[model samples]
Target chain A: MISLLQQEIESQPEVIARLLERETHHIQQIVAQLPPFDYALIAARGSSDHAATYAKYAWTTLAGYPVALAAPSLLTMYQARIRMAGALVIGISQSGQSPDIIAVLEEGKRQGRPTLAITNDGSSPLAAVADHVIELHAGPEKSVAATKTYTAQLAVMALFAAALSNDPRHMEETQQLPTALEATLRLSTPIMQAVERYRYMDRCITIGRGYNYATSFELALKLKELTYLMATAYSSADFRHGPIATIENGLPVFLVMPLGATFADMLTLAQDLRER
Target chain B: MISLLQQEIESQPEVIARLLERETHHIQQIVAQLPPFDYALIAARGSSDHAATYAKYAWTTLAGYPVALAAPSLLTMYQARIRMAGALVIGISQSGQSPDIIAVLEEGKRQGRPTLAITNDGSSPLAAVADHVIELHAGPEKSVAATKTYTAQLAVMALFAAALSNDPRHMEETQQLPTALEATLRLSTPIMQAVERYRYMDRCITIGRGYNYATSFELALKLKELTYLMATAYSSADFRHGPIATIENGLPVFLVMPLGATFADMLTLAQDLRER
Candidate 1:
């Protein structure tokens, strides 16, 4: 099943490219429509929501937009304390038919709020309600679990940032996304191999910081979802506060050392984990 | 610092109550508007994000609103490919001054969407841009670590749900929230005392399902945050897939059991964990 899903993902490269293009266009259109306000609200659920965290860092530093991420429950279920008179609500999902996502959009419309949706299914209820719709175009993800859609969402989001900021340099950088994804797919082999080493280990700690913090989270989620591994994600700083005490010689600690300003700190934290 | 923070939190019951009342009234007024929309978007950070997730369940089942949660990163950095129009964007925060949150709201506004801010600080940038404001009366949360504010946010959200649905049943149930919180606080005493028993244990797992699943995640977060304990949270069924292999005699496993549908299933799982 994993292999089949991987194939489905690989076959969707064109879909990814198209999704990125459409997302870029939508963002540019939204940017063209109104005056800049305070910040952007990136709303999603499950794996797509985790990808939004990654988007937060990319948009803030790369696109120079202040952003905040939230779950829909806050608006629909929570007392309508939080209000947006002229803010974009970007809803994301693979199926785009979840009742929660639809309800959120309905409430927004009644309030005369502008809403958007990114989805794999163009005909999904979410798409029907959205003022603008960016199709993921990843095709049918047969697995109950999501993999390609996740990466596609991330890619599309990155492209959207490039479009909104009108940064040609960033846009060019996004062109490399497919290649990077391919490279990442290759890298997963070694990671899977490494997993065999820890298959017998009692517990696993996955650690990263800053933007990579979400990567660590997604990695842990994937490990749990795919391999059913018992793993926890933590920020490098938080790991030292107490989780490290459990390091009894040879416990598995998978560290994601993504290149960024925080790389040195993360490396140091990884070293500390090893020493412990 | 931790003790001081704890003291401040304990002493703020009156403040929390007052803030709760104020915020509840504000939410009622907002939901009464029930503006036409397709979906709701909630943007929040940190503990407030957790409260948002808790609200998602209530929104879907109780108020019958389709909602989606988002991270600010998607809107600010990645410009996530989401359809944004006719949707309400909600920004939630205690301080409401996080640069990312501001950026996301600004982006949403530029898209001509309705924006809302739910905050402890009405003067914060988040509130400054919001079309509607639900000010959390949480008073001053002195702790860098949030406790009472999180609980208060949950309470406010619950009350908001009740107000929106015009269903006082949940509201009446929630009136017991303060007492339940007090009981939970009291229950923690024994859990804290018992922490010593498992502090030395090499591994710990926390499991729950449905709403309690979020509780399990929060519990793991607390354990990691407060004690630096390496803990993993999982849905009860998800645990069986692969994490169960790690279960053995002497490994510590914590179950956050709610008195509902999952009780029997969790009991069986607990027995399996014990046997393993």
Candidate 2:
């Protein structure tokens, strides 16, 4: 029996492929229409926030724009008058119903700053409030745990990053991501076996760095939401700073280190944790 | 015999008072000397990172400068070119050590952006690279878990917030903060009694929002570093988004709700958690 969650999970490659194929020109047009901005202020919650986290690395690295994750409570609750000058305000949401995320875009619009929303629902209030809307087009996400929308949001961020960079290599790599995701999904059988070993695991920590920092948080959120596990995510460097003390004899620590510039540091931490 | 951690914790009021009295003018001068900047990018690790979290809210709300906590790995591990134009790069570290943080300030200086260091050690490498330095005059901090330096860093953030605003009332309130700390410390006896109840607690989540969001992380870090408890911190808004499902019977949860605009929303979350 294919669970809706599993179906959504397996559909990621297709969803991302469709997203890139359908939205590449649209995202490029959106980027072209935008005014010159010095930085990006992104407002999101839950899995969308993790997408923003990925964008924090992606936008800064690829597009040369510093990205900051906005604390929506500052606008909605504290009524803070945050300086939005020279900022491209962005809101990322699936349903786009969250008032806090919407309030940030509204504030950005009120301040006359350019606002953009990346959401699954183009008709959502979040999209309505933004100067530009990048629809996920991942179709209806009914699993309630946000499996498809999360990846779709990441796809949108990758699209925006490529658009902003205007580099042929970046665009080619963006186009190839769905194939990479598809190949990655083929290893689920071994991953399922590995999960069997941790059937009784109640709590754990997820560690990643650089772009995968978003992967760490997203993984933790999925574990918490779907498995009802108390999973906390930390950057590998931050985990070393103090929480390394929390590691004992039999505790589980998940490290999300992809092969990249951050691999060596994460490998060192993994070796250290393994020795413990 | 009092534990070293307890003694250092008790010294927070005096440490903060000494910091405010000495560094207020210095911070003002640093702010005045700075070339006008559009935003602030801060880098830190461990408890110092929590202090940076406080400044993210403080600088945005009081000073009207959007604050972004920088991912140091971008500069260090990835060797990524980040646009630092119009950014006042600041690094906060008690020891002013962490090469990752200094790397950020160094890159900021390389990009011709103004840089600042908030550290207890004026002679450290971080201070050497910064255009200006604000010393946390909390004297010698011997505790392993960072008790005095955390509050002192918060004091420095408050002072900077006050200095940037140039509002006399903000300065007056900043001056009186140490007195408030002293008053709050009087509740230690009850807090001690409450601690006894959680003696067997192995894991918990700390929640806060707005300015006190930093307090939640600081408290969680202290718990992890000192008590070896698996404590995670989340903003109340973020908590409701998903991790709230982890709240089962007998699970310990800490909420840091300071009296402010965020109080009511926190109270609602508190009530929801209490019912659970």
Output the number of the lDDT-best candidate.
2
Which ranges in model 1 have alpha carbons more than 4 Å from their true place?
A12-14, A21-27, A34-37, A74-82, A186-196, B1-218, B222-229, B234-276
lDDT of 1 at A20: 62
Model 2: per-residue Cα lDDT at residue B91: 96
The candidate that achieves the highest TM-score relative to the unseen native structure:
2
Residue range B114-201, candidate 2, lDDT tens digits? 9999999999999999999989888888878888888888888888888898788998898898889899999999988988989899
lDDT of 1 by residue, B1-276 (tens): 467667755644555567655666677777777566545667776567767776665554556544456555454434554444656677778898877777657766888778878788888989999888877677777655677677677777777667766688876776666566666667767877887767565447888765565677667767666665667877676566445765656668888776765678788998887766
Report the error of model 2 at residue A93, Å: 1.3
lDDT of 2: 0.88
| Residue B52 of model 1, lDDT score | 74
lDDT of 2 by residue, A117-211 (tens): 88888899998999988888889987879988898888888888888987878978889888899888999999889889899999999998989
* TM-score, every prediction: 0.64, 0.97
